[model samples]
Structures are given as C-alpha cells and as structure tokens.
Target: MSNEPDQQSETTTKTNKPSIINVAVAVIHHKDKYLLGFRNAAQHQGNLYEFVGGKIEPNEHAEQALIREVAEETGILLNDNTIVKLGRLHHDYGDKQVSLQVYKIELTVEQYEQHKYCEKGLEGQALTWVSKSQLLAGEYHLPAANKTILEWLKLPSTIVITYPLTHFEAQSNPKGAWLKYHQEKLASDSWVYIRLKDSDSESVAEQLMKDRPDILVILPNDNEQYLDDKHFSTTGDTKTTQQVVAKHLTHSTLIQLFDEIGSSTASIQSLPKDYPLIVSCHDIASIKAANQLAKARLNHNLPPIIGAFLSPVLATQTHPDTPPLGWKAWADLAELADMPIIGLGGLSPTMAEKVIMYGGIGVAGIRQFHQ
Candidate 1:
C-alpha cells in the first residue's frame, strides 16, 4: 500500500496537520530470515510489526542514516558496502507524509555469529527474526509500509533474452555470440528464454538446452518429450516469434481457455497460478490487459503474473519505428500494472539502477548481454 493511491486508508484522522518524515528502512536479511521489530505502542499505529530503521536526520544521506539506525536499534553494525537497494516507498499518512528507502543488509559469518543474539527489545519494542515463509503468510500483519516488497523479494532482478539468429545475421563473432552469451549469462541467477524464431528453432533449442539445461526454452504450442523441466509452455499463441516468445495471455486466449457457456463470462480465472509466467507488454493498453487478466486470476486464488517486459523504454534498432515510452511513461504504466515488471529494449545491466528507481523490478534485453 506504500505507493498505491489508496494509501489514504492507512492515514490517521489528523489530515489537516502537515509533516514530512524521511525514513531509511533496513530489511536486515541473513539467509532465509529477516529482522523486524515492533513499533512503540505509544506512537501512531503502535505495536505493529515492521522492519528495523529510523528517521533520517538533517544533512545525513539515506544510506548513512540506515547504518546509524541499524547500529542504534540493534547491536549489529553495517557499512555502505554491506547494503543493497531493495526498493523505496512513499506513504501519505494524512497529516504526516513519509518517504522510506528500503535496503537489505548483507552480513558476514563472523558478524552473524557475534550478533545473532545481540539484539533486545530496545526502546521497549520487541524484536524477532522470522523466516521467509512466516513473513509471506499474514503472520506479521506488517503495516502498510511496503506491501509489494514481498512480491519483489521473491523475483530476480534480471531477465536474459536469447539473440534470435536472424537479428544477428549482419554481424559475427569468434565462437558465435548467441552460444557465447548463453555460456556467460547461465552463470548468473537471471531467467532466460531462447526466443523460438530461428529457421531451425527445434535444433537451436536442443543445442542451447544441451549446453545449459537450466534456461527456460520457449517453443510455441507444440511440446516435445525431451522438453521435460526446460519447456516454458505459454498461455498465448506461437504463430510468430514475438507472439510466442512473449507468451501473452491475450483476453481472447483467456476466454478460450477459461470462459464457460451460460451465465459465465470471459476471464483469465483459469490460468495456472503456480506456473512461472512472463508476459510481454508494449504499451498502456497491454499493461491494462495484463491487469485485467491478473484480476481474474486473483479472483481464482492465483498469484499475480511473474514479470512484464515493457518495451521501447528507449528507441531501439529492434523496433526502430515504435515511439519511445521513455522513463516517465514506463514508470506510470508500470505503477498501474499489478505485478513486478522489467524495462526491456535498449538497456544494459547498468540500467537496473534507473529501472528500479522508475518502479520496475530490473532490466531485461536481447543484445545487451550477448555483446
């Protein structure tokens, strides 16, 4: 609820009063566990479980304040190098507005061993280390600080795309860029898809999978017996490379798969909930369509789609004629969508910092990693 417009629901009655408080929130994570503390019962929204952090004082940078807050609230000390940017949230609590920068603290073995039991109910706020599962379940009943943080936490920050053979016919490499890129990227934690566009797609898929069986191999409607755990079947069509590669669960597609006769209606309610899905979205209409599909799926007790690839964030050679979405447009559309999205087209891994700032999970591209 942090960035959602409905954040007013969390607001207190003192809507006339005005105050701006900048906070640095630390999601101090060690493996599967994260540290959280109870809020002071005397303060507004008292006794609620929330991440450990404190207000940023004048002249202090956000990261510096996070380090100070963690050391003060808990015995564990942290430096700028140990912190990773998780996300940011802005909450308008009626009278007082709050801007919070969230971070994940990376600790060393020695630090964990020394400070594992070093924290207490400092300032009369109880502290507990909870597992990831407990955090996901509504066990903590976490305040409206950053509800979508959990969703972003479960997803990776990068998505890799295979450079379709045709796109690179004009260029060449020593060992072959496509094959070499696969070798280089497979070492990371990013999700990858070998876009089924080549003339010998089946053969290309085999070689790529044989080289790195971990990558998700996307091949249109047909499924092969050898495609055991590697096949990423789609809820959309596969007539063209873009259509099949993006795996769009179009409204019609959902209607065909999930809609019923009689009083029933067209909806995406029947789409697989647990299965990993990555849908392509080019503009606002696509984003809205995805949102509608997600709403239907949620009504059926399904989780939101995993990732949306927003294209043309910058003008690119892939689709040179399409107008650019730019950063603001991309951010606006992404905020409207229900799930985590990746900024695609004309971006490198470095764009991840900007992508996150613009409300996207991270960056994805076809040629960036390949080069």
Candidate 2:
C-alpha cells in the first residue's frame, strides 16, 4: 500500500490550559443588528470596538456571569432563555492568557435600546448597534475576542441536507415536501444544504428559497454555484452565492491557495479575512487540515474554517461495514474543537439533544435526517 496517512487517524489538536483566565463575553443581538461597544482609551485594547462583557466570578456559570455582567455593563437584563453558548476562544496577550466563554444574547426590539439608556461610562465604554454585513466585511475594527462569534455564524445549530430524487412517502409530491420543509424550517432562520440527486432538483430548491432569501442554502451539485467545482463563481454580491459553503474540495484546490505550503495551518491564512470558509472532512488528515486552516486564519488575523462535520458517526446502508465514531467518541471529538462540530452519517434530528450534551452543535445526515 502507498504511504498515505490513515484517513481515520486523529491529528487535530486541542489545547487545555487550566491557568487561562476565563472571560464571559456577550454578542447581544436584536433584529439584524448586533450590540457592540466602543472601547474607551483607558481600557485594554482601548479604542477598539468589541463585544461588551467582563470576567467570570468564582462558582459562577457562564450564563449567570454573562447576565450579571450585561446588567452591570449596559443596564440590560438577559435571562436564560435569551442566551445560547456560541463557542470558546483562547487568546494570549503575551502578559497573560484569556479563555473566553462566549454566548449569543437576544432581546426584543424595544428592549434592545436598553443598552443605550444605561448610565454613562458603563463598563467604561460606549455601546452601539451595527449590522452584520459591515462587521463581516471588516468595515469596523473589533477586538480579537469577536472572532469566535463570526465562526459560530458559520457553524449553524442544525444543518439539513436535501433529500434524494425519490419523492417523500409522507407527501404525495417531492416538490411539495421540499416546499413544506422550507416553509416550516426556513422561517426560523437556519442553514440547509441542497444536495439533490441531480441538477434539476437542486435548481428547484434554489427557486423555492427565492422568496425567503435570508436563509442560507448550500448547493453541492451545481458546478456554477459550487465553490469547489470547476467554473466556480466567486460572486460575493449575489445572495444565493454568498451563503455558499465550499464543500468536499480537492487537495489541489487548497494547495493552490497556499502554494508549496505543506502546513495546512499555513494555508488557512489565505482564506477570506472576515467571512467563514468551510470544507468537508472524512478522515483525520482533513480534520487536521481544517484545524491548520483555522489556526492559519487566526494567525493572519482573519476568519478561518468555522467548524466541520465528523462523518459516519454510525454505519449506514451505503457504508455498513465502516466502523462509526460512537456517541462517546463523537462527543469527545466535539470537546476538542474550538468551533462547533456537527455529527453526520445515520444521525437523526431527534438525537441532536444528545449530540449537544456530548459537546457537538447538532447532527446532520443524508437519509437519517430523511434527506
């Protein structure tokens, strides 16, 4: 056999530092605008705008600490229901290290203004609301702590892939079912990968999303829209194309991006600085490649691979003989990832809660999620 690395081998690295100081950060959002703070000249990383948050006290859970801090910092009250963990971040300032337990905070339109009414000089900064487009394009200089927030935007909670050519039994027609899924699912603001059996089906899925253009749709089979395919269009202005997540790209494509660079980590430095770039990984090498790419982006001060899907979590009809990464192994793997990791292969939506308990963002599947 050739000397190719074991595709299944584990090469991804996760750092655990007990001394890294924990900081609870908030990404307070209302409507489509995010609440940001302009760091005053007196503070650390002064003059740079970033998320408003503070240190976590002893014996305090991240959510509780975030609630207390936000109240103290902005005079805004955030309850448990309005908060969700985005991910974590470890940043070294040379003098000391900080481990940020980041969370996404939501509030009503009226209450969103509560931040502005706060006592002057709250947390020694001025708070302002900014749109995601400006923030993602690097129009503003936000502190490094905001990186993971952008990463989580790429790592959606539930990623539903489109079904094959055969029509669903529950519905009389296939198009009807697809429309229903879009109507019910897309209404909540989520991401879906339209990997139809052929171009016609993928085209239909694209048209269905025309009305609700806000939802993210990934087209894996269409060459023109597929970023990894030949004749790939890099049309950032097109809403349909902008949400595209480059999937299952070839080794050559990555090599070309970083040219002669053996380190996958180094290659990541070439990705878009503010937006996320995603690729599918089946083995340890690809995962490590993604890890390197993420590190490389961070190294160059850019947005890197936000997350990845660990495939074949359980054996299926297509690959019944392939040993799966069982629940514990999958969960353990999730724990190591700094970004949200989604489980795939024979996974069902019902199992998503367990996946979260084990550290994953959620589960994705082809037939299991009734693709």
| CA lDDT, every model vs. true structure | 0.60, 0.60
Q: Write the per-residue lDDT of candidate 1 for residues 1-371, one digit (tens) a residue.
A: 01112223443346545455678888777787787777655555565778878777789987898888777777677863456555455555554677667666657767767666745644545777788889877688666655545655665566667766665475665226656656665644345655645444454555555566444443322221232222323312222222222233433443343334223533243343344345677776677666555545434444545567777799998889989899999888877665667788789888887887777878887777553
Off by over 4 Å in 2: 1-22, 28-35, 55-85, 90-101, 105-141, 144-148, 163-190, 194-215, 219-240, 243-275, 280-289, 301-303, 312-318, 323-326, 349-354, 368-371
lDDT of 1: 0.60
How far residue 355's Cα lies from its native spot in candidate 1, in Å, is 1.4
Model 2 agreement with the true structure over 1-371: per-residue lDDT tens digits: 00011112221224433255667888877757887777656545667777767767789987788888888877787873356555667676544456777776668767866554543435455667788778767777866656556657655557777665464656677776766765555434557666555444534555656655766765442222332222223323255665555443333354344433454444444344434555555555555555555556566666555656776678777678888878777666555555557778787888877676666667776554532
Candidate 2 residue-wise lDDT at 260: 30
Provide the TM-score for each candidate, comma-separated. Answer: 0.55, 0.59
Candidate 1 TM-score, C-alpha based: 0.55
Q: How far is candidate 2 from the true structure (C-alpha RMSD, Å)?
A: 10.4
